[model samples]
Target: MARDYAARCPVYPVRNAWLVAVAVLLAAQEIGAPKVQVAEELEAYPTESVELSCQFNDGGGLTKLTQVSWIWEPSDGHRDNIAVYHPVYGQSFPNVAFKDRVVFLHNSLENPSIRISNLRMSDAGRYTCEYATYPTGNEQGTTTLIMLSKPKNSANGVTVQAGTKSVVVARCEAADAKPAATIEWLAPVGGNHSTSTTSGPDGTVTVRSEYRLVPTPADNGREVICRVNQKTQKQPWVYPIKLSVEYLPSVSIEGYDHNWYVGRSDATLVCLANANPEPTTITWTAASGPLPETVVVEGNKLTVRKVDDAVNTTFICEVKNRLGSSRHQITTVVIEALEDPSSAGVVAGAVIGSLLALLLVVALIAVLLTRSRRQQRRGYPSSGDSIATGSGGSNGGDYGNKARLLFSNSGNNSSKNGTGTNNNGPIYTYREGCDATGTLTEKANDYHHHHLHHASTGNAPTAHDILLSSEMDEAERRKFDLDDSMEEEEERYDRFGGVAGGGNILPPAYHVHRGHAGEEMDVYLDDDMESQRDGSVISRTAIYV
Candidate 1:
């Protein structure tokens, strides 16, 4: 059956050779072999010393121990003798490759283990402990020495790839590790992945991991990390992959479709988009208003050129690229007017300034008015009303403390006389505070006693007394004029007996006369013969003129 299969299957020859070699080694080690076991297998570094342990387990029957030998077999070549130990001849290393570098652990009884110094990469291979006895023949056990190597990374980390929804290409490799290196994807994204391993002639390994992903916009610019783990290294080796995905534009507006006042200086809108191959053209179009005559559509900025009552309209901004195009729309509100911010400040400042000035003026006027009132109140008693008595005699002294004065019609200042003298004026109305006329007034009851005394004596009048009355107030002067008018109607003065008119003459006495209408007229007795008398005619007896 084997011969028939070898003829049919061309790969059978190669597989049979590998099987035969392994079978022969197994057969040799099983039959008549001493119980020899290698306890430890160790790693080696150049210029370092290491010991490979071989222990005798259930030692097979042997009358005399012959020899113990250590053999070195490289991974790519045949076996070699590292050293041999004998009870009498001692230990000796015959292999030129491990000449001075190897020694037996025991001196007598043929040591089964050997120590090696100044280890080199060439010394990395299988090591065997061989026992030689008279009857048991040769028996051996083996251990392998592994050479250590640091891992290396491959593939560019910044390679950009255009990926689709179904399949995205990403690759990472870790090379030059002793055994096969374990490769894994740290961040497993999108979909599944596959891996492969290859080996070098020196037992160095390379592991390559490939990823097939279904990428989306969210995955654009993502980093895919590949990690390689090896037994010789303390930590896993890692590499990053930057992925870029190409897709349609994702569109938005930054500043668009907002209310803009009519008087605003600038009204602006913005359009934003993320796309592959970038955007080549940017444009703005108006729906209801006049579009800008010449607008440079270079960027995402959209300037609403004509913002007025006429521009209450909608606007559209378009961003275009090689892959696709995107558009955004915005509407404007037609506000009739907007307050100028700068001008508002100015108007407010002016209003405040004007109000301050008005308040200052009002305050100053109030201050001046208050001062005038105080001065008027201070000057009231002495200057507003005054009294001067020309007569310094009993009449003046009597009138000094009087509250009220009433002059009778029969007195020298009475209405019996047509010409009233001494400025005994009419009564005047009194008002509070000072008047604009600046008139002066005084009570005249102080002169009543003197007047009575003078009348009893029948004194006509003194020039000094009449002169003293001349210095009267406005109220006195007005009263005198009123009395004089009434007296003129009631009395006619006789030039023969009454006081004289003109030249400031004083009144002598009071007299009454009858007129044509049978009215009595008060007349002054003429002292200078200045009055017309009835004796010119024959009095009332004569009657006719």
Candidate 2:
């Protein structure tokens, strides 16, 4: 009975224990394991290195032993086993490229972390970290490494002179690059140019650019720049330098006046010039002809003394510097001479003489005209003279002849009386010549026959002849003298004599004459000869007292 009980209990009880173990294994598969997430990635320069690290959760297991492994996968899908560690296998690396350059700092069974050095372009790839455990199954962490290229080395230098023509050369170089950089000159590009490129000792390429041009005055204060270009950049870099240069001088001249007159005492002019270096020589020369003896030049001043009338005289001022020489010219002219006072005086005298001659001719013409008018008013021929006479008789015949004689000689004494006259009495003797004495006598008988016919019948003898004889006295002759009178009396008689005298009878009588030797005879009479005249005979003489 005991043997039969042990066989039955053994198969049945052991089968039940195997079924419980399978159930526990199935529960462990349902819970998920903790994992490390790689949220960011990095890349580094060619000369630098990178490290990747991660943290994990053990899922409450008492045993700390676990498996960790590192693997690398290239972009071409090739996998490389890098590092691994377990409690039994210890730390191990599979590839030679990761021998010393790759390192794991933490124990892979407890933690998963890594470091890498001496990175190269070939080491660029994606990496993975995996963990193995009993309770919490498999987990993974990922990392990516990328290599970066370095910038190329390019530089240049330049030099220039101020204010002159110049050339500038810029050289640029770069080494060990997949693609080379381009070189350029950043200044104005239109002038002359030359370029050369040569390889350096280190297998790097170097380029040189040269530019040549004539500089201006504005270039003195300006700058020249060089620029370099690379493929990775949008803008180029610049380097700058200043320029300087040297040159020649300029000249100008100014004078006191435009034209210098002849016989001027002095003439002067001034000159000026500009140059970097002062001029060594300054000279003044006559441009047209030889200079006068009085011409003088002192420094920049030109002077001419005692200038003469020599057409146009030209002068030049020349200035010489180290670089070059320059000159300026001036011209002068002279005037004619003036006249003297003697010539002016002669002209004035001629004019005055002509005016005086004209005045004299006009006055002579006026005098001739006045004399012609006077002749016309007097009823006389302008070119000749004439005389008229009348006769007087007794019965108006001899009496008319006597009156005519009286009128003709009114201005003279001859016709008034020639001898003594009687008035109805015996004849009287009239003295013919009383030359020795101033007395005259008259006889009665000489006059009786001349007057007897008119004496009777109450008719007396006319006393006209007696009164005319009385006018022959010395006192009346003295009163008639007109030579001593002013010229105004003579002019009145000559101009108006006919108009002043009317026709009238004058008295007539006898007269006695006397004379001195070598002298003209004179006439005289006594008043007693007219006393016996009768009243019937009329006396026609009108006496002016």
Query: What is candidate 1's lDDT per residue for 25-138, written digit by digit as tens?
Result: 988876656577785477876568888877654443344567788888897679888788877787787888778777766565534667889876567888888878667577
lDDT score, residue 545, model 1?
5
The top-ranked prediction according to lDDT is 1
After the best TM-score superposition of candidate 2, give how far the Cα of residue 149 lies from its true spot, in angstroms.
4.0
TM-score of each: 0.45, 0.29
Lowest summed lDDT across 10 adjacent residues in model 2 is found at 399-408
lDDT by candidate, in order shown: 0.56, 0.51
**Poorest stretch of ten by lDDT in candidate 1:** 536-545
Model 1 TM-score, 2 decimals: 0.45
Q: What is the C-alpha lDDT profile of model 2 across 215-318, one tens digit per residue?
A: 54344434456555655445765656444433354567787565455666667778787654468788887866676677777899877776675425777778
Query: How many clashes show up in model 2?
Result: 36
Give residue 68's lDDT in candidate 2 (0 to 100): 79
